[model samples]
Target chain A: MKQIVFQHHPGNVSSIVRGILNRLVIISFLFGSLASISFAQAENEVLSIKSPWIREAPPGIPTLAAYMEITNITESPISIIGVSSSIAKMTELHEVKLENEVMKMRKMADITLNSGQTLELKAGGSHVMLMGVQESFKQGAEIEIIFELKDLPAVKVMVPVKKDS
Target chain B: MNSILLKTLTIILGLIALGFGFWLAINQQRNTGPLISEEVGIVYPQAREIGDFQLVDFDGQPIDQQRFKDKWWLVYFGFTFCPDACPMALNDMKKIKVLFDEKIAQQVDFAFISVDPARDTPDRLKQYVQYFDPDFLAATGEMSDLQELATRVGVVFVVPENPENQNYVVDHSTFMLLWNPQVNLQAIFKAPHKPEDVVKGVKKIIAAF
Candidate 1:
């Protein structure tokens, strides 16, 4: 009778250990999925920069403009606070408007992008002013243009220096 | 001795024949080289003289009214910072020069004067103007001085209301001013300018003169 009772007591301990192992596996699976869901959201692969280029001018010309298209793939809108480039002495957001039958340019502080909207910066319209170009931007060379956002980390875009078609 | 005298007479007769042939070529061109031009550029009823003004050349040399005398001047007022309009205009000016005869080409002077002197420097102008043509001249100087030249050239330029913004784009006219030997403004070629139109317009204007 003593041997039988010892086996019965061991059975209780084995059951408790098995229950703890099962709970741990369930906890691990839940945590893994939760981490992956947040990681995918944080990556924000929906936003993209496309076809960035600087307008070409004569070698000694000191100023030129850069153009690009920004696309917001996410369902929410993106807000742009500022832009910068190391290639130029300074950079400013500008827009060209027809005023009194003549084209005029003005500086813009910030821009807001709507959901699923692609903003185009082009000639005779919006552009990035690159002032005091020290180095000649060769036709095939690449330059980095950084966009400062309101919420996310700054993104650096590599734009090609090309002539206007 | 008789053979020597005959040779001298033959040489004199040959020289006279050559002179007569040259005279005939010159007379033929008067009738053949010129045709009555149907369409001419808008000519000012009175060619207004470009009054006394002070500005610097690409070399930073001071330019007075008298510096432009004794030549046909084609002056364009624009900034080097301009991407499309300015380069296209200057390039067309170069093409037009190529179409002219060497004598006619030598008589014309091409100049690019910047209204945006705050940003355009003489050193930059010196290098920038040559990109279009080696013979072209570029200049920029004090605002009042530039205005004196601009007004005489019939170009209008306006700066930004806020001068603190160093990156301001200037609003200026794009037409090229054509002037005569006396520094008088004669005609204006409006932009979206074509090289052929300029060449034809200049030829017609010269023929009228």
Candidate 2:
């Protein structure tokens, strides 16, 4: 009887151990699925650049304007501090402003990129002012512009120089 | 008697040739005068003189009548947001610059004054001007002041109501004002003015001064 009782006790202990192992496996599986979902959500919030282009400068002129659209997918705000191009001696962020009655243009320190927002840098508005051009910007030519973003890896974009429409 | 007759005929022939030469010279003189005079057409009304006003350039520098003195200024008034006409006009101005002789260009100046000062700050004006010609200067000031100057130059500028509604457009005159060294508004050329006309007008005006 004692031998049979000991065997039953050992069986119960084994069953309890097996039950805890099963519960742990289920908990681990749930955690893995939740982690993947969070990662997918984070990946979907990447910012994108669009419609990047540059204006053709007149002959012998060393300055030009570059325009683009910045689309933010994140739920937080971002900002563009500046840009650089190998083809230009200097690149700056600029905005067209109206002081009093005159239309004026000046360099901007930074451009805000709001969450899930799109900002356009177009002619006669905000634009990237490229100065001291190293080479002539021919029509239909593709040039590379590297945009520096706040707290993110810089984005390299190819912008076409086109005739003013 | 035969010798005397021959001599008289020769004399008559000489007189006829001389008379023809005289007539040709008189006609040439009359025609040449008008040709030269017509070359100097009446100065366009808007180009007559520069009005007194204070404005700031793209660099936030103050520009007034004094800025135009001692240099030949080619001034045009337009906004940055103009899609077609303004850019076309500026391109023509650029062509005019290319057409100018290098020595003459050194003494010449170009500017684009903003008619829509409400949106065109000095900084925005600068970028637009620089895009066309790096050497070009842009200026803007109070709307009332610009209106006053535009009125004097016969330019029409009307700001649309509700400009903040995102579809606002400004209607303004399209004229290029040419000022001479004496700071006088020497002449005004209407829009769609040819680059050749600008070159010719500028050369003539510069030659006169």
lDDT (0 to 1) per candidate? 0.76, 0.73
Instruction: Count clashes in each candidate, considering only residues at least 3 apart in sequence or on different chains.
Output: 0, 27
lDDT of 1: 0.76
RMSD of 2: 16.0
Clashing pairs in 1: none
Docking tier of model 2: it is incorrect
TM-score of chain B of each: 0.77, 0.78
Per-residue alpha-carbon lDDT of model 2 for A99-130, expressed as tens digits?
Answer: 43334455687777788888788765777777
lDDT by residue (tens digit), candidate 2, B78-147? 7776543467678888899999998778878998988777767777777778878898888988888888
Docking quality of model 1: it rates as acceptable
